[model samples]
Target chain A: MSGAKRGGIEVLSGNDMCVEGALAAGLSFFAGYPITPSSEIAESLSSILPRRGGCFVQMEDEIASLGAAIGASLTGRKSMTATSGPGYSLMQEHIGYAAMAEVPVVIINVMRGGPSTGLPTKAGQADVMQAAWGSHGDYRTAALCPSSVKECFETTVKAFEWAERFRIPVTVLPDEIIAHMRENVDTRCIAEAKPFDRLKPGKPPEEYEPYSYEISKEGAAIADFGRGYRFHVTGLAHDATGFPTNDPEEISRCNWRIIEKVEIARSAFTWTEKFMLEDAEILVFAYGSVARTAKDAVLRLRAAGIRAGLYRPVTIWPFPASEAREVFREARKVLVPELNAGQMAGEIEKYLTRGCDVEKINRLDGEIITPVQIMEAAKALHGRKKAQSSD
Target chain B: MAGRRLSPAIDIEKYLRKRNLPHIWCAGCGNGIVLGALLRAIARSGFRQDDVAMVSGIGCSSRLPGYVDFNTLHTTHGRAIAFATGIKLGRPDMHVIVVSGDGDATAIGGNHFIHACRRNIGITAIIVNNYIYGMTGGQVSPTTPKGSRATTAPFGNAERPFDICLLAAAAGANFAARTTAFHADKLEDLIFKGLGRKGFSVIEAITPCPTCFGRRNQNPTGVDLMNLIREQSCGIEPGGKSEAPAGIRLGVFADRDEKEFTEIYAEMAAGAGR
Candidate 1:
């Protein structure tokens, strides 16, 4: 396989962009299992990471892949892992562990159609819910969705930054379409995205406590292994020193701290691309690869003299709820077209005000929700809104 | 824990997180003995405390890391070896040790355990074979001998037990050995050799779970279980044959030079970078 040469503009698939993004984000280790749609990420990183003074390992399974990445991250390395639908399902256990342990790790899930191996080579946004609630816990993690190759690279870099800043695993979701589709991306522009790393313990080893909020208000300030800090990290609910505790107050604080920390930084993590959303009566909400098609439909609808606009959320989870509320405030009609069976639509419905006519077009036959289909739904939604307004 | 002194010269308190103790392991449980052996081994290895990282999965044995004053990580159940693989690869200079239970290593985490051995990635896996899941309350584990009674196996365990050392050797670990908690000195020695080895090392420490495994079987107390283990185990002869009956054979099973994952990776990585 030919590698992407550094510098200048290059045509690269989303998976290739992930490798470039990971490298740009100062990734020092990657451990992943080979799965369709996401395998290219593991394949590319396997060679590239080691060359850059990093380590890449093809782990035995998806669980181990995330497990290894978490371990590496704990040792003061910016580590990541990539996988697909079934593989993502396999990683949920460790995902919760990473959250509970407050390990900074990046996990990229190249979305494909599936409850289990439903469609390996095709795209689907069905994992939207899974990305948010796959792991059983009261926790929150930043999840990013990139619609194009360039966005893929940029978003992957941002994923690392968020993971580091929050001391939690951040997921980057790009469907099989975005993962395999090649597009032109400027290396210089993507490189401009800044990287973030966790805060290291500022005090002496003897004086340091691993998870003391009094030490740092942002990310975890635990010391790395072999650095003489000699701290403990555990998946069980723990006290400030990172030791397991059965105390109700300590456990409640541990659970709430992980969830509320991300929630507090919700505004910083919320990101969206509003296309012609100004004064548009018909606002279409979508994300991931399908958002690209929705944007196209919005453009086509505008040409046909329909007041349509696209609101695409790059940060899929933590849902950009406030922006959705503000954007949907004045719109008379809203439409959500997705590759899944109305997953994002349900999320959209949660934020909209009463009396707004909303419609959703869902496709689950391993085919993308085409722009024509979205335009039809938007037109119908617009028609109902217009008829009601006239009455 | 109050009166018994396993090794007087080692100054074991220096290697302990005293504030986090009294450990949660049940009374008469062999996890404490295994932990004591591991500590003694670490002391003998002469590695800097800062240069050692102890990782463990969920179990009574896995809880050992919490009581140790090292760069310890208590990860999810069945994933300690996988996590240790990452630590060893990330910082090859550090000595990484994984303390796992029989169930943690061979049941839910069986795939990762075998793959870690295959990679030979310079991790010392101290699989504490208590033959039952002590943390979860006497459940039948993958290492529980056939016909053994457990909470889950009210009648008797029908599945065959895994010989952890043989499994490690066959799976391509560079060093593999089996020693019981009753043989504390031997367990310490074996763990020391495992720490010194340059590739994946597996030390299956067969310890008693007096609260769970022992009470269900005929061995009711920790001492009884230790005596049972002492009676069943015999060292390998010079010719590598054991004269003991069909019981647990305790000795080194494999030790040979092979390319370790980190060294090979580093060499290859060194050549590729600009």
Candidate 2:
């Protein structure tokens, strides 16, 4: 790890980075019910936030925690809630509400092994799929993954920014490893970050349609609450006016627009790191803590004269499909290693398996995929391919 | 039930959303009467429609938010008061009202209710205690009177019901009142006082669940439920000594002025340069 200071910025752990990121994003309220791995986010906020003119509430349960956070967001304050797997499951309904109601809130899901309470203290990237589709309905959601402690801070800040700009709930999907890992993070990276504010209605209150989308040069515009702009927000499909509308035509238009807003703004939402892929014959795709192992494996493979590269996705939701396709198009084979049983691998196959050989190395036993395991997988694939060519 | 009448001068219709008609409430349900009382109080208090925010958790009574023409939030089960606390803190200018049912408020949301009371946020909570979980069938609720037969407790309820008003009083609510839907006029008066109070206030309205609690408890008609309320309730005069009735107690049990949570928070913030 780097020393306590980097480029005039103080070094910190991933959990401390989350706290710094939250503060940098101008979060004024945190309502959370603590669970393992994710509890430090709430604990840090409870101590630091009140001293910084913000409020931190330990709600009775995960459901109420998200509820209070959504309530706080509606009042024009940047609000957030943090939880692990079981708690994340409890928050799914409110997450849908925040999406439908266009409430700006950030949810940090520090994942653990689960279908339900599977492993409380262990790390797992099992929630990648859940973060995208856990909430009911056809809605556009954003989930960002941070591999290192520095990225944990930076991604949390980005989550709040995107939530405010898009007027939707954003999730910082960190697994237990990154959430609990100690690393030196430069907080000054956040100091230079620009925050996005909620879009205010341009017209008078009487003429303003709360959910009405005006395609600006930037993107879809959002109307902030308490700006005298009144409209109904329901969990049901609604028209541009935000009133519940069952009309299929209106619903289709609104639904498509919801998708379009995130789709068209993909460039701004995507984050990735490409290593030694220019002349590489093999590409390893991974994310979260698995990406960290993959990076080490790639370095080892390069030292062994086996030209291999690594592609790490920082934003897992819009699933870096296009970039993964581009990277895989030139490679002879692509390897995907994840904590879950091929969730992201399935998504990668949807986009990147045109003609290249695709392979998956999965572990569901609530243990991190070690660097040696990744290197072994790569070597096994290489030996098999070399044997086939010799035959 | 027909003999009593509220003032015709009160325009209760103004607070209603006419397009969202054909309400989900059962026919002859006293929830309509309780809704009327709340509207009357809002009208009488002279609060601007824009300045009022009604929040509710999931239940038949919690559906009150969808019917009201105000800044409303129909939230998840048992979390209305927590949501209301956020709204009150976020917009101190708005008159925040939390309408919930027994199951929604006292069961799932009981902790939030007690904490909100303990914080003493300047908000009014009107708990429509129908003594049954009406939305999800006649399930035994936290406020289901002991020995009553509910779907969950088919033989008979072994658990004692929570007296919500007493809980609020114990939790440091500045104002706490208990009334039934039959007493619409008095319900409105207490609701108005709660709305005007500077600290956390609770008005527990003993409403009728005609489809659930009523049918299961052998009171099939809404009028029969109203009669039960009338017969069981006895008045407790404000600040005067009184004796309890045979069954449920009626009227405000406690009312006092105290520093609200927001005021104290603001003062503390100001002291700390917020």
Candidate 3:
């Protein structure tokens, strides 16, 4: 699909670009069961994949979708699956398996309202925590947030790279708006960006320990079946031998590798966009589609002679606390306008400093936090800061 | 009796992980015999050991993957077939086999099992039906016969058991068969034949759980359980089988030629390229 012709902008929904992004990232296998808003990704890929020599399988359920993806990843192919809230819940079991087995697979969880199937078509950022802690036990993973159609395509490509880089399942969170909203997308840059494929063991079967940590600084090599790597892989905690082990010290050593490898790469994996923070006295923190509205609020406050900036974290998990620390250092107040009730704001509060006052502008009734709402919240904070500084 | 000594012709030691010697199955447990037959089948199937992948869900029988020297995957409860289906589809070159228990394969993983059969994926699913959940201490299972006692069914199992072979046949599998662990030679042959088939194959290998299910009934020892199976079961004629009796059948019931899932998928890929 890549050519040396002229490039132009075209209108495509975020979900449509998600499929395009996956194709561009060298994804050859997609196993997904449909859910609302996110269903278009599967539907589009169903026809697109077969035409491009890739496989698109509609599994019986959500659990099987990720199960198949994890299964496919063992063959050393980049694989992906998509779902919404309830489907994401069912996928948690296999997500844990993918983590424990160190399988590189990408999961696209289109955020929708929920404690349980709360809103099928509406957007919410409630799954941010779920994406981090949804799977059981101790493991470290990366979750990327895409706020627009362009980011959907770009971040998905990056998600595959991150998953392959760390040998962990990476989540790409796009909300209902970004998933369905049609926007101008330029496809030229994607053709040039290279996707990272994890290293495979060059060592012979005799010397290969599949879970051995000494191979690469990023992660260990995963040898494919029939290539004579003939290794044992399981979900239970194991030693470097890739077999189950109950030893406390070896378990810690095994556990720390998955976490340390990802943690070491955090600064490189973390992506945050900052706007107008050079001389700002107030700040608004947001992500996903809500970040777009937060930007509008920032612009409105700036136009009104109020020094306010926006910190939009493109990488949500691995928290981006370091990036936020830079913002908190300058702004006297921080406003977090989330679609959920203070989920991201609660996160920001954890890394938040002593002098900065935090204001939460949350909407939990299956509605987006509008720019007007964020503008009002930022203005109120700006006014308070202006008052304090004048005194 | 089904256990009457039939000399095992193949050398099974080389296929096993010698370091993990002395498996976890109980002394009289039939899992060992079934596992031995599977290893022999793998040895004689003409497929390279590296080209074969054994996927299993959680259970006593599911531990087979840990003992074998191959590309083994130990998955969650009841999802072995699902994961195997993925492995078969992803590579389309490897021979994927699922080794799981009745409770894991037919109960919790029942939906995935039927769908895999329906898709007719090129994977052989070997289901070990021990009539009771052995790992959890004698709980009722999907293949537990009616009126049988279990820890879950103290008085008696009021529910009806599933006929795994028939279910596979109904779900459009190309091959389906049932045999007991005691009939090691026949079961191995059946598995070899199933692996030889192009599409999905389900072999319900009835294994005795004397420590769990056998003592619940009067058959306390593993030998007693095998003797009971020999006396109570009937051999089905080719293409002649019924599920009503809930007894083991000692031969292949259905073997047909059908276009497998991966073959069809490959055809699409080739056509797409053209």
Candidate 4:
């Protein structure tokens, strides 16, 4: 069952687009386990990757899936894995391992309602905070939120780019709504986009150091195994030579580099989708599936002669704080409409300037927040603003 | 066993990272001897240094990877096999070997170990079964003897220990063998044979953690533990076709030709032309 397409466009679900995006980004290996709302990505890659001379493995479990992906990545293959909330939780340890060992891997989490397997088949965006700090210890990696099917593809590619560029695990967060929703995706631009490759050791194998703290200058540049550069890789704190170390100075240097690499490259990959924000007093902050609803709500509010604008942070982590500060500068009031109970609203509150009232509309009962709910929240926010102005 | 040559004629020093030593194993730990056997096996194997990847999980035995100079990866606890599985699948041409402790392999990493055997991928798993979690201060592990004393089981363990070789054989590994740190020559020979095999091969090397395990047990020294291992083990007779004895037997428990996992995947990948 497929929809009609014009030119280079094809109808695909968000998960299907993730597969397409991974292929476009030179994904050479994939190991995954099936989970709700994210199974299609693994199923599609199983048939496609092998055909394209890439490798695919359905690992024993979620933990093994990411463990295998990390191993494949060490061999200079662009590797990835997909999962839902519970599976993502199981992958947290390896996520930390990948970060500590400086392995470039891409993980796609199709967000579902959960503290523990809450609603597997339904949609939710509650994994936003977990995406940032789920794994223990300090490490920075890009987490991208794609609102639409086309962005699902583009954002998947972007995730790979940042993973390779920063030599760290990058996560693509797509809520269950976007994961299952099908739409016609124009893939011409994405197809032609050049994929980023991880930096290889340019020096002789004898002098090559697999890790270093040149965060402002370069990301992790490593040599693939079997290429004659037999450097050690470990999850423990390590020195520039890639061997484990206990020296306090060396440990500090290693930790700071992995965290700062993403911060240094933030300007290049950080992005936001703004709709009619020039002189708007009420700013609507949202992302993922909620962002799409927010857009609809913003349009309706504008049609009703109220200045409401939608601001969606495409790159959710390395959290666009500077841009949030700039965008929230002119707004008198801000409204966050999300699936979770104020997960990202609290983050938005962190960046909003003084005197700006932040209102949150949360729905956690396995349902999407409708445009009407957002419009009502915006009206209330506007009424509060008017009352304050009159006083 | 009085005058046996534990060290091989090959230059194992070339295989070691001299700067990283002296190793972190305890004063009387048998891990050093096990590491010596592994080095001899690797030295005897025909594979080039660059083509071998030594992966280990967190443990005293896992620290052996750091001392050697191959493409070593000291990963998180209980994930060395999973990581080695990926490396083998990624580069079928590379010789991937995993070194994990008893608790790391048979407990936390049990699922991956059994699955790897079922898949029959070409990975040599040298499970250093010290009977307890030596790195974590002598906690009773999956392979700890039912009546053994550990820090976690001070009153003696009630849980039965696992026959790791039998477990590997039952899980469908192409090759499964058993030897001890005291049988250093046999340990090296078994490891070499495991490396030469086509699919998933397992060698459970019973070694001693004198500091953790032996301190609480009757055997308080490495020499005492070595003598205890020597006395308990029985060698398999040549041309024996009977089932393995219920106790520890020092020989190959299983060996058969099987279609390897990586080769099947490689064939499919090659056939799936762009």
Best by lDDT: 4
Q: TM-score for every candidate vs. truth?
A: 0.96, 0.90, 0.96, 0.97
TM-score of chain A of 1: 0.97
Reference-based lDDT, residue A351, model 3: 78
Error of 1 at A184 (Å): 1.7
Find the 10 residues in a row with the least total lDDT in model 1 chain B: B237-246
Runs of candidate 3 exceeding 4 Å displacement: A1-6, A215-217, A386-391, B1-7, B237-246, B272-274
Query: Chain A TM-score of each model, in the order shown?
Result: 0.97, 0.94, 0.95, 0.97
Tens-place lDDT per residue, model 1, B203-239, is 9988988899999999999989989998898887643
Query: Which window of ten consecutive residues has the lowest lDDT sum in model 4 chain A?
Result: A1-10
Query: Which stretches of candidate 2 lie above 4 Å from their native place?
Result: A1-7, A113-122, A214-225, A237-239, A245-260, A354-356, A363-367, B1-14, B136-138, B147-159, B236-246, B271-273
True contacts kept of each: 0.85, 0.30, 0.78, 0.89
The digit string of per-residue lDDT tens for model 4 on A284-312 reads 99999999989999999999988999899
The DockQ score of candidate 1 comes to 0.77
The global C-alpha lDDT for each of the candidates, from Candidate 1 onward, is: 0.87, 0.82, 0.85, 0.88
Model 1 lDDT per residue over A1-391, tens place: 3245567887889998888888888898999998998999888887777767889898889999999998888889999999999999999998898888888899999999987889999888878999889999788988999999988888999998888877888999999999999888777755576777777878999988877764223655657888889889998899988998989999988888888888877888889999999978788888988888899999999999998999999998888988888988887688888888888788788788888787888888889888999999988887887788799
TM-score between predicted and true chain B, model 3? 0.94
In angstroms, give how far residue B106 of model 4 lies from its true place: 0.5
Per-residue lDDT tens digits of candidate 3, residues A29-137? 8999979979988887777777666788999999899999889888877899999989999999998889888999999999998879798989888799888889898
Clashes of 2: 1
C-alpha lDDT of candidate 3 relative to the true structure:
0.85
Best-to-worst ranking by TM-score: 4, 1, 3, 2
lDDT of 2 by residue, B55-106 (tens): 8888888877777778777777787887778777777778889999999888
Q: Which of candidates 1 and 2 reaches a greater TM-score?
A: 1
> Relative to the unseen true structure, what is the C-alpha lDDT of residue B156 in candidate 2, on a scale of 0 to 100?
82
